[model samples]
Target: MVKSFMTLAVLVLSAAGVYAQDIIQVQGTTPDLYVMHTVKKGETLYSLGRTFSLPIKDIAAENNISADKGLQLGQNIKIPLNGANFSQKADAASGGAPLYHKVEAAETLYRLSLNHNKVPLDNIRKWNNMSGDGLKKDTYVIIGYLKGGSGAVAHTPTPTPAPTPAPAPVNNTPAPAPVNNTPAPVSNNNPAPPIENNTPAPTPAPTPTPAPAETKPVASSGSSFESLYMQQTSNGKNATTEKGPGGWFKSNAAAGKYYALHNTAQRGTIIKVTNPLNGKYIYAKVLETIPQIKGNAGLIIKLSDSALEALGTNDPKFYCELSYEN
Candidate 1:
C-alpha cells in the first residue's frame, strides 16, 4: 500500500546544520489558535505536550485522536494555543522558544501581524532583522514564541506546486417542449339549433375552512446573558465603562452565547456591550485582548459576528459602549 502525506509549510530549524521536526502551520482565531505539527519517529502525545507547552489531553482533543494510541510517522496534528502556551508580549523572548510563521503568497507584513495575534510590526522586523515591509514568498518569520518550550526552531523553505485550474461545467439533458391545452374556438359560420332542457345546475361547493396561521418560534435576542451580567455588577465592585468604536470577528459560538476580545479586559471577563444608536445590549465573555493591529486601533472591543448581529447592526465598525468588571 502507498502512503499519502498532507503537504503544508513545514517549520524547521537551521542553526549550525541542525534540523528538527516539521511545524506545518498556524490556524484558527484568537483563544482558539493552533500550530500544525507533523509527527515523527519516537514522538508521542506526552512529548508534543512538552514541546508546545500544551496539556497532553488538549493536543489529543484538538486532533480528535486517542491519547493511548501511538501517533503514526508523518501524521499531522494541531497543537492548541491558549494564554498558558502562547505569548506575543515583549517579554516572550525571555520565557519561551520562538515559533516561526512561513510567509505565503500575497501576504503583507501588516496582515501577517494581524493573523498572528497582532504582534507589533516593529517587533516582527526586529526579530527577523528586516528593514523593509516587503516579504518574499516562502520566507519564515518569527511571529511569536511558544511558552515553556526548550528548543529554538527556525524554518526551512520547501517548494509548493501551483494550484490546478477548475474544470468547465457541462450540460447533458435538454429541456422538454411546451404543450398547448386551450380548446379550438367555436366556428361562427355554422349555428347549431337550441336544445330543449339542461340538467339542474350542481349545488355550489362549500368554501374551504381556513387553516390556522403558522406560529414560527422567534429567535432569542440574547437576553439570557443579562442574568450573568447583573450578578457580576450587583455590588458594582471593580466595574469600568467605556464608549468607542466597536468591531467584530468570526466565531462558531452557539446562538445567544456571545464572546468578545478587549485589550484591557482579562480572559473570561463578562462585558456588557451596548449599541447606543438603537439602545440594544448583550453580555459577552472576553476571549483575549484584541490584536493591536492598525485596523483595530482606537477600537474598544471586538465582538463575535453573531453578537454584532444581535446588537442590530451590520456595519463592520459601529459606535458602542462597554461596561465590565476590571
Candidate 2:
C-alpha cells in the first residue's frame, strides 16, 4: 500500500536536527507608539504586516500571538513598529517551532498556515490527537500553551457570578370606600414602582424563510477509495485506474503537501510508521487507490491546512515519520 513516502526522510531529520525554540526578533524598523489593530474581515497577520510595513514575527510577539492562530473578525491585536522596514529571521528569539492555531469559523486550517508562513495544519491536528475531525472555534490546540506546563491540558470550568435576590414586598391595609358621587384622590406615600406586567406579549411574526444552502466541493465515490500511497495528478485530480485501494501512486504525486480524509472514512489497511524518541506512531489512512508508478517505493500524502498544524510542522515541506497508533 502507498503510505507515508516521507517517513524515511523525517527519520533522518530527527537524527540530526534539534527541536526549535520559541522566540522572534525585532527587525530594522523604527517606531515608538504601537497601535492596537482589531482584525477585520478578510484580514490576516501577513496582510496586516504588509499594510503597516512591519515584520510578521514582530507583530505576533508584540501581541503574544502564534503564527497559526486565527483572528476573530473583531478581535483586537497589537500592531508592532508600524511603518517600519523589518526582515524576519527563522532562528530569532521568536524563532523555533511555529505556533499551532485551532480551527475556527470561516477559517480552513490551510488558511491559517499560509498566513503564518511556517506552521503546518496537520501537525496541529496530530499534536492534539484530533482524530482528523474538523476543529471548532476557541478550542485550545498547540498555539502558545502556558509556560512551564506539559503539552497536555487539564480541563477546568470558568467561574460565573451568582444571581441577585429579589426584594420582598411590604403589606398595606385596604382603604374604606369613598362616599357616593365623590372621587377619591390617589395616595402619594409609598407609591409602588411601575410593574412590568407579565401578560404574554403577542408572539413575534414568523421569521422569513431562510436562503438556500451554499454550494461546496463534492468528491466522487472513487475519490474516497484510493490506496494510502496514492499521489495526486498535476492537474489537481486524484484518479485511480485500479478498482479499489490495493493499487499505488508515486511520492509527491499529490503535487500539494498532503491530502486529508475524515477519520471515519474507510479504505484499505494503512502502514504503520514509528517515531523512536517519543514512541509516537503516525498512522496513514487509505481512502482510495491508484496505479503503481516506477522508482517510487512509498506513497506521498497531502495534508490539509488544519491537518498540518495539528501534526506540528512549523515550517515548510512538512516531513514526518509514517508511524502507526494503536
Candidate with top TM-score is 1
Residue 220 of model 2: what lDDT? 15
Please provide TM-scores, in order, for all candidate models, with all chains considered together.
0.41, 0.23
Distance from true location, Cα of 3 in model 2, Å:
64
What are the clashing pairs of model 1?
Answer: 12-154
Instruction: Mark the regions of model 1 whose C-alpha exceeds 4 Å error after superposition.
Output: 1-25, 28-32, 152-326
Residues forming the 10-long window of minimal summed lDDT in candidate 1: 161-170
What is the per-residue lDDT of model 1 for residues 153-270, given as tens digits with 9 covering 90 to 100? 3323233311111112223223222222222344443355332224234333333434334322222235656666667777456578999999998754566888788888866678
What's model 1's lDDT at 119? Answer: 74
Off by over 4 Å in 2: 1-102, 144-326
